[model samples]
Target: MHLILEQGDLTTVAVDAIVNAANSSLLGGGGVDGAIHAAAGPRLLEACRELRRTTLPDGLPVGEAVATPGFDLPAAWVIHTVGPNRHAGQTDPELLVSCFGRSLDVAADLRARTVAFPAVGAGVYGWAADDVARAGVAAVRSWDDANPGALDEVRFVLFGPAVLAAFEDALASV
Candidate 1:
């Protein structure tokens, strides 16, 4: 599996799928979630609404993922996963790991050859960038090992240089 770190807009990624660090609501909130919803246009929200009415009545639980059409975004699909928030008292590192793992699991089910991810809990959720990088990289690496060549590439599309550096460091360690 090819792992890459790129510093850019997640909405611009032309991958088969891009992972959104969403809240349980599945409805758009701040950070990556809001930006993705905005970029993907109103239809994205409508799709999410349909999901809420159907499968995710309560909301997407932490570490679980569900996919929706990318709408106006460059990606073909948008995979949304709720990360564990430290400020909210969800501090388990494994939950962060599950965010990456389950997103990939969903991508694999969709036959997505390329996927992009943001640092799952590194924003308003208050997760440290380095810790997020470690868990994110490890989960992707572990999934790659278990699934063999299921995915061609998994890119961490960070918005800033610092977080990108952390992901690069984590990749080097792996």
Candidate 2:
């Protein structure tokens, strides 16, 4: 999957899957997590709760991901990836990269052709937008090379101009 840079609403993407910057609880929270939960309807929350009850560990850390259907969004599935909180340091960087990589792997497992990913950890998590962009682009590039044609398109969807610009710069460099 070759990464493509795009600035748009994630809910509107007609991709096979969209990566949601979710919390460890897998429940709705603020930022991209909340938006995705809201758009996906109440069923999404219910699904998360059920999944947590059966499969999720008792005290799992962040950077883990779970997959669910997109109840209302255009994409067929949603990959809920838990990113680190503010000031998490180097661990945050690696976790953030893993978030992207894990989401891609989930998408690939589902045979997704196109996938959209938001800037993981860049909102309430307080990761610098530029750093997130850089790590995300790098992770996607590496994954694409390692698993050629695993996905046809991988889009970086930014919510704002600043994030979009950062992703554009990162994409150019990669």
Candidate number of the best TM-score: 1
Give, for candidate 2, the lowest lDDT window spanning 10 residues. 57-66
Per-residue C-alpha lDDT of model 2 across residues 1-174, encoded as one tens digit per residue: 557777788878888899998888887898888889998899999988888788884522577777999999888899999888776553458888888888888898999999999999998888899989988999898888899878889998889999999999988887
* CA error at residue 119 for candidate 2, angstroms: 0.5
Each prediction's TM-score against the native? 0.99, 0.94
Per-residue lDDT tens digits for candidate 1, residues 38-110, read 9999999999999999999999999999999999999999999999989989999999999999999999999
List RMSD in Å for every model shown: 0.6, 1.5
Any idea how many clashes model 2 has?
0
Off by over 4 Å in 1: none
Candidate 1: worst-modelled 10 consecutive residues by lDDT: 165-174
Question: What TM-score does prediction 1 earn?
Answer: 0.99
Off by over 4 Å in 2: 57-60, 88-91
- Evaluate all candidate structures by whole-model CA lDDT and list the values in order: 0.96, 0.86
